[model samples]
Target chain A: MVRVVLCNCPPEDANRLARQLVEERLAACVNVIPGVTSFYMWDDELCEDQEHTLLIKTTEERYPELSRRLAELHPYSVPEDIALDSARVAAAYHSWVHETLSDT
Target chain B: MVRVVLCNCPPEDANRLARQLVEERLAACVNVIPGVTSFYMWDDELCEDQEHTLLIKTTEERYPELSRRLAELHPYSVPEDIALDSARVAAAYHSWVHETLSDT
Candidate 1:
């Protein structure tokens, strides 16, 4: 099954993380989208700031390995890494992802 | 909790779905990205084709409702509506998603 993982890291760290993931072939492609603003409550205070969002494309089988790599390289104590099983896809493109990563 | 749902549907069906979700406020915003090619195996056949991907932004609390709505309107027998819990975010932007949906 094909999967898409939604990940986020500090804006400053986005490029390095993306390069590492792509270099490792954990992702066929990593689109770095900026200008994302995030807000959450933590440590008894509500904080708000800007961040970068990474849209990662890969396969289900690679998730574990990919996730492990992300944890190792990620700067946050707890980085946002969520895997989503794609519901339906065009058959060929799915195969392309499988092929691309398999070659890696 | 802020959430991002990655959804794929036929390119032809993409616009209507995006408009519906936004109008209904199930999503604060829906980004329609085209030129996506997908491949998969089904019914003993490996097929390939094009698709449009929708990146939906909303709150975790609204997932069930959004998923249900997606199922009702989606063209595919099993549409791809996968919810991913965001791991970390800037404090204020997280609150914005919460606020936007609440107002809806």
Candidate 2:
């Protein structure tokens, strides 16, 4: 099973985390997207921020450890870790992602 | 059944598409992320492009029509429409997405 863990963070933090995740093999790839204008509600008020989002690709088996490591490394007190199901990855691509994982 | 339809396009195209999707109720929300450097092989040659991605939030029921609309509006002959499952959406958020759709 494949999943893409999504999180929005400061651009500097996002870049650092993406590199670390890939280097550690917690993620096969981490696509860092900059210049995101997010408008969401926090504390009953509308808040807008400029944030970068990381789309980290990994297998289901590694998610727990990945999430743990991400929490520890994240700057925010409660960092977002939304795992969306990559329900239909191509066989070759799926195999490549698994093969890249150090723990696999 | 929440899904985030992912697609990459030119920054200007992405911005216009995001607004159109939301305004048309094909998507409850659309996040436009710019500054994406994508490297991929097409027709046996490696190609790289600076693109913007749209993360469009919608429900499963509307996906077929949304896809049809997307195909009609997208510039490319075959624009990518990767629908990743938002498997663990909050109750309020999920309901809101469904409720926002005009067809619902």
TM-score (chain A only) for the predictions, listed in order: 0.93, 0.92
> With candidate 1 superimposed using the best TM-score fit, by how many Å does residue B7's alpha carbon deviate from the native?
0.7
Across A1-104, the per-residue lDDT of candidate 2 in tens digits comes to 78888777877798899988888889999998788865433343334567788889987878878888887788866565667876588999999999899564
lDDT of 1 by residue, B1-104 (tens): 67777777888999999999888888877898876544443342334456777888878777778888887898877566656567787899888777778886
* Model 1: CA > 4 A from native: A1-104
Instruction: Please state the CAPRI-style docking class of candidate 2.
Output: acceptable
| Model 2 residue A79 distance off true place after TM-score fit, in angstroms | 12
- Fnat per predicted structure, each in turn: 0.05, 0.38
Task: Give candidate 1's whole-model lDDT.
Answer: 0.74
Error of 1 at B67 (Å): 0.1
The per-prediction CA RMSD against the true structure, in angstroms, equals 9.3, 5.8
lDDT of each: 0.74, 0.76
